[model samples]
Target: TEMFESDNVDLKKQMQTYNGLDHPFSIGDELLVENSQFLLKMKTDMPNVVVFTFNDTSSWKSDMNIYKAHSGFTLEAQNLPNDINLLGKDAPSILQKDQAFYSRTTYQIIEKLL
Candidate 1:
């Protein structure tokens, strides 16, 4: 997550500098932010999971955009909760170089009749 935050800050700073020079920001170098907290909570037993992330745009406020990305899966009931604190500690180390850890698990889903 630190990697994402640092990248976001750097991108915003670059955009600010560009704006100051009367230049337009390009989408090619845009940063994609993720909801690390919500992502870390998804379990394998759940039918689906939704993660929400916010963008860093203090540098430029004319445009505030929110994007939603989704994925579908079925849980097998053997998944467990992850230790988010430990993951946060490792964020710095992971961000130093351009890399990320991808984990997977199954969640139990309950059906509700309306």
Candidate 2:
């Protein structure tokens, strides 16, 4: 996929700058998604599929992995409760370089607009 390869190439350089915290995401990590508490449990084999448990109860699946250059991994919920705004938004095409992070390899979250 050209989109995949292009993002991977672009993010590789960006990820090299950060050393403190891993960027994009980490498994079992809790994040303030749309100003709400959410846990990124795990990544699945399905394309962009991930187990994102919201509030530790209701689990929602969506494309949430930063494979090469995809970012802003969104949930599959139609309308998130509590006025959470996970959908109806666009991930920035290129995240600020300072936001880049490295895991086993360098990567960035490509804006995934819905």
Residue by residue across 1-114, what tens digits does model 2's lDDT show? 232234464344433432111223222322223323332333222222221222121133446732332333343321123122443234322236688733231223333344
Pairs that collide in candidate 1 are 44-106, 44-107, 45-106, 45-107, 45-108, 46-107, 46-108
Q: Can you write out model 1's per-residue Cα lDDT over 4-107, one digit (the tens) per residue?
A: 23546654564354321121222221223225233322243222232222223354445553432112222222211232345665432233455664445533
For residue 38, give model 1's deviation from the true position in Å.
20
**Highest-scoring model, TM-score:** 1
Q: Candidate 1, after superposition: displacement of residue 99 in Å?
A: 2.8
Worst 10 residues of 2 by lDDT: 49-58
Local error of candidate 1 at 8, Å?
Answer: 36
The list of candidate 1 runs beyond 4 A from truth reads 1-94, 105-107, 112-114
